[model samples]
Target: SQDQTWNDGGDFDGTNTFICEWDYEDALSASVKEFGGHSYYVFSGDCYTWEEAKRFCENRGGYLAVINNQKENDELYKLMLDFGYESAYFGYTDKEDESHWKWVSNDQSTYENFNKAEELGDVEPNGDTSENYAMFYYKYKNGAWNDGDFGFYTVNSGKAFICEWDYTNPTPYNLNDGNYTLHYTTNLGREHRSVDFDRTYDIDNIATERFTKNYQTDLAYILSVMASSAYTQGDLVYNLITLGFNDYSLFNYYDNPVDERYEEDSCAFSIAKKELSNNSTLVLITIRGSYGGFENGNLLNEHSDWYSNLTIWFPELVGFGSHQGFDAAKDKVFEQLKEELGGDLLKSNVKYMITGHSRGAGIANLLTKEMRDEGVSVYDIFNYNFACPDVAKRNFLRWNFKGKYDNIFNIGIAGDPVSILPGVPGDIISLGGHLIAQWGKYGNSYWFSDNWAEEYITYDTDLHASENYVRMLSNQKDIGNAKNWTQMQGKKVRNVGVDVIVKTTSAIPVLSGLNATITDTNGTPIAKINGNEIEYYTTDNIEINLNEYEDQTSISVNGKSDVIVEFSGIDDTNIEILVVSTSENQNKSETIAYFEAVP
Candidate 1:
């Protein structure tokens, strides 16, 4: 073996044949070893160029070994002794900048091991720009590094090289329990908004507040209806104020400004002033979601390195930026609000609430940060977002918003995908294969775990639908009070009456022409047999018109109706009821109520 020589021509010429025996340790060959918490594999068969060798190692899920210290360099030199070769390529290079060497793995290495002096006299790595790559030279002062080129048979010829892999650091999405509180607002009713007057309410109080869940469910439904395309922008504002949102009034609406750059998708927002019972007004800013060209604009606005860079560059903005697109959209929205409300609205007594669904929700998140950074009082601001995306960079969110806003709540459905995307770009990189696992770290998230038996929870965009969110919240009840009730059916009994209630699920106000029908337990239409039909009445005891007959039965009322029924029976009977609304631009009908008939 000592008489043999591995020439640059890839020939083994000498006396006896040499046996390259490699010992085994665990899954690694003796040629493979560990140094500085990284695994390195050395190969010395076929010659390759620097680029070819780099690609060869990359295909194996690693890059050429990057030596960081004298200890590591010495270990690599000892491992090279078995190869019977003078040199091998490693991971050091100054390809980007001739003066500053860099590791192929993108890590910054401070240590260098160039030969101080050579047998020829001067030190190695003296070729300057001509030699951009480095190789470990065995004879140069006991394996010191030498600058080399990529030419074959030359100093940088594709020879044996080491591949390094890092497997020690844990993955980012390990679900470390976050320090913030988690609130499930699915069951809160709308009334809790008005009832909870004290601004001192904390997470614990919100978690345990009575009627809170039901209130939230109601509000979610209302907001979902508001997000529908059924009503015009002006009509939406009027309907919101008219439909029991008496505490709030529209401040102004900002139409998407016209700009040639944003010809595809534009942005719009509306402001509402809530007059609290405590003599203070709360400003609510609601941004509109994708409509027509705006969708294209949102998708085209590429991610920026800085939060406000794009907005600063272009007054007419269209994309979600590092600050989650607030720079383009919210900057204008904030400016409009400040101009409309004047300085008086920024007083300590004036509170602020921001809300939106989809793209609007994303804007709200960034706007919250912008307002807070501008010296706005944190305690006076409350943010409730639905199905929003990760608006800003992870570091920006962690350092700026996380643990800073106590009243902010982000509600998302378990299966919705929109709430988790624009993930670490490239397809090869994922955050533990779950977006929520990464976004959940940024704030207090309220996830609706019950996905209604959705097959693909994460990819189901239907689950992201605003209406479905409201429906799920409305149907969800406290676990302790879960039960089923009975409904009553037909048979006229003297002095016994059934009460009918009509409710509207649309954001558009319905005035009149609402109707109701009664059916038996078997779902068969029923009517009075002999002058004893169901009667329609209002809350003021005023009788309304009804067309009731045994064969053809139907009862019609105005916007809302109260009905009284007379049924003759000795045992309780179940009955079905259906209510239809004739309001324009609204859903046709819905099952209003069901009851049991008592004899």
Candidate 2:
């Protein structure tokens, strides 16, 4: 719409010919739009302190933003300068702590490009170093607004602030994963999954003998071979093929079943010599788990980041071995140790302690026992922690502690009951006579060496006093008592030559102390028991066949009842018998490597 007065031919005629209505409302509705692919906005009200301003912006569902790029900073500078908004509080102030200026929300610096001359203004001379924070001010000299740095301030000082937000990129997926790529995402701000080893050992054996000349010279080659075989046979395939392979490759120049050259962090000789000469008072001789070493086959490259003066001595022992044949394997360890270091290693004055975590503890216990059995005089053998199915053979000055929540040794099976006991019973009382034990967390148990001299630990009088220590129980269960019981009676009972006690609250079924007779074909009492029940215990399987005499065995209880069984006189075979006392309940099945037994 137009309202006009036209002048023509040098003559001015006011309100000449055409007139139109003019709407003044359109002029008031003009919206401010940004140009050059950018926009800007200034703080609207009176200035507030940095903290107050931050809170105000946060209340508006946004944070005090930081300038991420120069272009945005330029846009902000121009907008503020042109709009006559002189000095205003920006999000750049380091109110939390100065000198370590990081954005309160998304920390990024806008003054990284500030000139040296202007940088002097960023810090106040003789001011508190801890109170360095940046602000924005319009420079009257240059007619421009620039980000300025300042120090701590009082919250009451009102200052206008601009809130900048990140609009340059798309938002990330979630808070946990963070605004980073998957490959770069950090867990706990630490690179937890980085590989520790760079060298990898690939076992290829069909090569020439000339290539492995150096491997033949390695002193530990034979031990490594034996260890590898022991690992594979013991169902520690994961260790042999993975962690063991790494350690071996680093120390030796050969692959499995083959002679070859490899690399390690340092030569074994150097490492051993350094350890022996170390002046550190307390040396920790740790049996690395089947998978504790560097991966692939590499030295610990990043250890420098941990400590400068600490020395780490890693030994490969108490390695993988079958629990079934653990004693024999332990014997080998003792024999080999004696053969290698026999008198020399034992006499070393270095104050060192041996400790193992899980399976390693089993090996440590075995070695401790073997050392004692061989009459090898030793300073002290410390058994820190052990898992289930592990029995203390010979007493040592070792401490035994296990949690009651541990379950490694309690599991059992129907076919075999003796699988869980260690080795075979011997001529002496089992150091850990209570066959069935309740272990604590992770089935870790510790038997202190003090127990040997004092019979039992003074502090451990109740045995169950410490809930952290696994509680031991005899394997023998009163069958008559157990079968008739309506409730579980797990109370520990002493076995006095067959005299038994039954729970009164439940059906009291006790084993008969008096012995009955068992006949084969004609008539005879024949039952043979082997292995030590008090000392070292080994696994045993019971096979019962009812043939001649109808497989008859009689049991007579002193106070309760007399019972007898008869096998049908089927065929002409003598009756095979299996007799288990009330105390012989346990899992005795051995693991044939890794395959779970199929029944």
Leading candidate by lDDT: 1
Error of 2 at 68 (Å): 37
What is the C-alpha local distance difference test score of each model? 0.46, 0.28
Q: Per-residue lDDT of 101-206 in model 1, one digit per residue for the tens?
A: 8888877778887778656444867778888788876457477888777544454334677767674321211112322111112112211011111223222233
Which regions of candidate 1 deviate over 4 angstroms? 1-235, 243-266, 294-324, 396-402, 423-442, 451-458, 476-599
The backbone clash count of each candidate, in order, is 37, 51
Worst-scoring 10-residue span by lDDT in model 2: 265-274
lDDT, residue 150, candidate 1: 51
lDDT of 2: 0.28
lDDT of 2 by residue, 55-170 (tens): 54443334565566666566666656565655555565544565445677665454443323454343222134443444454432332233333212422232456654333221
Candidates in order, TM-scores: namely: 0.36, 0.23
